[model samples]
Target: MRVFDAKLKLQSQLRLMRSENNTIGMVPTMGALHEGHLALVRQALSENDVVVVSIFINPTQFNNPEDLNKYPRSMEQDSKLLSELSEELLIFAPGIREMYPESVESVSYNFDGIEEVMEGKHRPGHFDGVATIVEALLRAVSPDRAYFGEKDYQQLQIVRKLVSQKQLPIEIMGCPIVREPSGLAMSSRNERLPKRLRKEASFIYKTLQAAKVKFGTESAIEVSDWVDNEFNIHPDLELEYFEIADAETLRPIRRKQKENKYRAFIAVYAEGIRLIDNIALN
Candidate 1:
């Protein structure tokens, strides 16, 4: 895999590939490569002539500075994994200054109503930071398609909005959430989770699964309450919020609509490491 820290050099390489009519795909990530990240890379490899994965930990997205400080970084291991994926995979692991130079002004985006729910509401300016970095990466790579995991369902929707609002010529592909055998949603933050709490983290997804089942027979409020109670069973798992909402707009749904798609979104803290997961509610 060829690794480039400078965005312009990477863009130049991609532009030359474009001259030869090669289609490119990009998977933007914040390092700490796991099965979840490789899942996206695999999909991109299958469909595109070239795949570029950026591993810069975007500082602007984290509202809690401590969270940013603790975010994992394993570039050596990450490179080894990507190298195993394909010798042709381009790894863009740029430094913070490389991504946001001192002279560049901070960029913010209006995501309309999409940013007002879940992650956005809880972490103010989070999505704007997300949009800023994603927009920069999209512009730099200018790939035919970009890949993201559905685990962050709201962020996926907001990115879709960002691409639309900016009129960027790129397809945002949302891949399925990759999980462990115990049903825990795979995440980089999982590394920080104490090994004992790792198994307990599966409770987050298990609760979501149970909530999904109960949604078929209970009211939104009832199911929400049920989720709250389910998490109470595990003192280590702290429930922040759970909402049954319209999948499209992410607006909370008081009543289930046959015509509208819905999803259950939840956020929890397990041993102080925050984890988020979502499931489609039929």
Candidate 2:
């Protein structure tokens, strides 16, 4: 595997691949590589002639400075893991200066209702930061296809919206959420969890599963309340928000619509590390 720290050189190399008629697949990630990340890479490798994995921790996306500061970075370990997966894989690990050459005003995006719920509600200007970096990476790589994990379900939908708004001719593929054997959603932030809390973290998924079951017979509000109560039993698990919302628009649904699809979106704080996860509810 080869690594490039500069955008120009990476794009230039990708250009050579395009000239050779090779199809490119891009997986954009903030490093601290885990099985979940590798899962995206595996999907890209199976479907595209070449796969480009970006490992840039975007500063603009973080609303909390402490969270940004504590976010994991292990370039050496990340590189080794990707190399073991595919000797031909290309890793783009750019420095902040490499990604943002100079300071500039923050970028913003309007996804209509998509950006007004759940994560968007709590983290102000978060998606704009996400959009800024995603758009920048998509523009830089200019790949035929880009892969994102559905673990960040709202972000996935927002990205789809971003692509639509920009009219970028790239397929945004959303892969399934990879989880640990205990059912905790795989996340880079999972690294920060204390050993015991890590096991307790699986409760987040368990609560979502319960919400899914209750959602069928219970009203949206009832199911949401049930999830809140479930979290209340565990003092360490602070319930941020739980909503039964339209899977597409992410607008919280007070009453279930027969035709519209729905999902249970959840966020929680365990010892100051925020983790988000979602599950489909029929």
Q: Candidates' lDDT values, in order?
A: 0.91, 0.91
Candidate 1 lDDT, 1-282, residue by residue in tens: 899999989989988998999999999999999999999999999999999999988888989999989988899999999999999999898888887887433477777787878888899889888999999999989999999999999999999999998999999999999998889999998888888899988988888888888888999999998888887887798988998899999999898878999999999998788999999998
lDDT of 2 by residue, 1-282 (tens): 889998899989998999999999999999999999999999999999999999999989898999989998899899999999999999888888876778733587889878877898999989989998899899989999999999999999999999999999999999999999999999999989999999999999998998888888989999888887888889788999998889887888899889999999889999989999999997
Candidate 2 least-lDDT 10 residues = 99-108
- Give the lDDT of residue 36 in candidate 2: 94
Model 1 accuracy (lDDT, Cα): 0.91
